[model samples]
Target chain A: MIKISDLRKGIPISNDPYGDLAKIFSMRKDELIKILNDMVNKGQIIKFRALLDHEKLGYRVSALIAMNMDDENIEKVINLAHITHFYVREKNEKFPYSYFAMAHFFNEDELKSFSKKLDEMHINYEILRTVKNLKNDVK
Target chain B: MDEVDRKILIYIQNEFPIDDRPYLKIAKDLGLDEFEVMNRIINLYNLGYIKKIIPKLSKSYIEKYERALVAIKANEKDIVKVSEFINSFENITHNYLRDHHYNIWFTISGKNFEEILKQIKIITEKLEIDDYIILRSVKSLKLDTEFEVKK
Candidate 1:
């Protein structure tokens, strides 16, 4: 089994994976490449990508929208550029929403416009605006 | 952030090279100096535009772990204490304070549902928060967080 902590420490998000990881893990460059290739082939590591800060990218507003809607209607919301995550969640008395979506907007006006669209579509939903992100460990 | 920076961000966010000299490859493709490209990336990080450039784990790999989106209803007074308490757990990947009745929302993952439940129990008892809901993700419709940066 691979030690995730060690691997994470070796290959940070901002550093050069090949050179930095090899140096940090005390492995040869070729060996590190082979290991990374193996991991990719095994479907462990999908692809390397950059995680952008949406707030700095002009997305000032982020909210979690919960709704009890049909799957067909999801297409409408999915087309929106603001939507980041859309998932079908388990429903209960405490949280009666079945469909959940995470959206980010450039400003409140954009959010209002999106909300207006939802209102026009007659989709009953509850908006849970994220006040603060206490912890977000994308490991 | 300018046109070149936007282009670089879009490319890196979508398809980051896996080669040894990845930044050099990016420089070649963009017709810029390797050091310039690297410096721009560093600048982006310093400006807080880019968080990290890491490998995205496959869905199958992630499916090995049990995960759930937990919503906790903590009083406004104890929000900070409760947030700090929940954030202390390594299993908790995401912890956020939302504007709702069930304010504190977080995603927790473990080896199994039992382990996740155990963690929840510990948190509830310790924080004195009995009002909470664990909303397990039934289906992931869209998980992409890539944003198209415009001029």
Candidate 2:
């Protein structure tokens, strides 16, 4: 079985995958191709993707919005284009919100608009602007 | 970004070809020169727009491991120290400081719930944190990280 650490090391964050992956894995082109294909076929690999920086792509603001709402209202939140990730989590007395979403906006105005829409829908939510990205390395 | 650049970004963000000559394939599909596609991608990477091109693992594949989003309410004075301590764990993939009562939020994954709880215990004990919550994901409504590039 392939170790997760080895897999992560073999595919470090870079734009140039053609040169980096093979060299890091120390495998021939054909051998590496077969391994990658096998992993994909086994459902271990989803798809190759380019992780873009939304901030550099004109998204100047990002926020984590936690919501306390029913399941019926989730589709409304999902319909919003700015929401990148949405999840339903176990809630408790201290953390009363069960739903969480991460959204990116072009500016604070966009966030305000989003908040207004949530208000119109009567969705109880708290928008927490991301202060700093401490770490985001692939696990 | 121009129209062509936007198109390239959209295509790659959705499905980057996993082939020996992925860029060449992208160029062919977009009816552009291979060199131009390669140059554009490299430029985007250099400008910090494209963080990386990586093989995303399947959700089901990773669901074997228990994962939870832990939120910690650390004092402003010790925020930096607390974050550094959390980042030291390889199991912790994402750590972010947000403007809220539970300021520090991070996602951690482990082989089981007990293992994850053990790690959290160590962190809480070391940092002497009393106010925190572990929000285990029950259902993921939408988890796509890709942002649609607009022209």
Candidate 3:
């Protein structure tokens, strides 16, 4: 199947990719529009988005942070600044962390400061610094 | 990145002109030559500021598939094996190694919650590491995001 992720890839939308999509499913044009519209209404589909190189644009200090919080308090923990790609994950016995986020900052000190505040609040956390984006492709 | 380049980047966020001469249209709007706009975009890509210009598909397109954020706690010996194992899954989109006890974090895409659990069961049994957590996006605060370039 030609996945939707493959469609939004910044390629020229030329022959090969489009041709590949055509090969996949057989559906009427009008039906696809209606089906896509229905999905969009239910929050099933975020219609459009852009993935930027924030580091190149000067938001260099970026990392994924996981915060330990109980089920009821996950939302409160994530009410921080500049946090995108946020999620409330399940908590386990071994690792109590239940929230995840991507933080982008222009300065490393700012990022350190944010982490320090979380620590001061007695919120256990882990900073998963991205060493290198090995495979960024969204399958 | 200079003013001209910044202008170019700003124009293409979430979309680009769809035409035979798309760059030409972009150049016209920015009051720069087509080649200049193309050159700056190319430069940005080479500098790693621009990953690639992708279509930015809708998340709903795969609404049928189940997805979750999974954190697997593997020991030092099994870290590499676990990472490789997570990468092997078909719909596992983004994978990462965090500096936490649950070092291996990856997203799993499946038909439903049961399918994800099945993948986890099979892998944990094979690798002999049973500790992990699964997090679903209960509410997507943000997705398909774009960054603003300072002038």
Candidate 4:
């Protein structure tokens, strides 16, 4: 049986320069398109994304920022630039912060200004800079 | 990575056309010829500006998998080995060497805790380091990484 996992086992897309999905999978183009169309319509495939590398795009100063703020402004917070992942931490007394977000900026000044803006808005937060990315594969 | 390219990136990142010629629709929407958009996407893919265009399954839809973040400690030299070992696991999605005592960080997903545990054991035992934290996500307020082209 052709399972969904089989679709993922093809050439690691990042490593492969040429996308020969039909040739690699040993399937005809029409059949592959049908499967893809069905997947998209069913919401199994969210979208065909072009995930830009923020660092490669000349943006620097990335951080894992933890913020403690009231619940009402959560909608306002997530719409900012370079914020890739935003989540509310599992309720734990020792966790220190309730919300976690990942942000990237062109420089330290920009990063600090964003943080300062959050602070001025009465949002208390802390951050940890990213030293290196080992693996950033989208799953 | 100019204006047209960024527009293409931003447009395609959120939604993909699922027709016989998907690029044709994108061209129509972006006010460009079909061939131009296709060529530009091919170029972007060739350049490492754009990663794979894959199926992004929803959490509720792909409920078989569960995810968590972990932090590990390592000195300068052994960090390479640590990252290699952690990323070797198919389920380990995002791994980073961060600026902290628990410097090495990564996210992993699996069918369940049992599957994740088997991979974790390899790291804990092989590295001979036990300082780590498993932070499970309670709720994802926002789970997108869209770039700004229009801005």
Error of 1 at A58 (Å): 1.5
Runs in model 1 lying further than 4 Å from the true structure: A1-10, A13-16, A136-139
Docking class of 2: medium
Q: Which candidate is the best by lDDT?
A: 2
Docking class of 3: acceptable
**Ordered list by DockQ, greatest first:** 1, 2, 4, 3
- Superior candidate under lDDT, 2 versus 3: 2
Name the regions of candidate 3 deviating beyond 4 angstroms.
Answer: A1-3, A8-50, A68-81, A113-128, A131-139, B57-59, B62-64, B75-81, B148-151
**DockQ (CA atoms), all models:** 0.62, 0.61, 0.32, 0.49
**Best of the two (2, 4) by TM-score:** 2
Report the Cα lDDT for candidate 3.
Answer: 0.64
TM-scores (chain A) of the candidates: 0.81, 0.84, 0.62, 0.80
Ranking by lDDT: 2, 1, 4, 3
Q: Which of the two candidates, 1 or 3, achieves a greater lDDT against the reference?
A: 1
Candidate 4 per-residue lDDT, tens place, A90-139, comes to: 54444467788888888888887788778777888878899888886543
State residue A110's C-alpha deviation in candidate 3, in Å.
1.4
Model 3 per-residue lDDT at A10: 44
Q: Could you tell me the TM-score of chain B in model 4?
A: 0.89
Q: Which residue pairs clash within candidate 2?
A: none
lDDT of 3 by residue, A13-130 (tens): 2223222334344644344445544545655444432355776688867688877754655566556666767765556555556677787778889898888777767777778876
After superposing candidate 4 on the true structure, give the runs of residues whose Cα lies further than 4 Å from its correct spot.
A1-19, A91-95, A136-139, B62-64
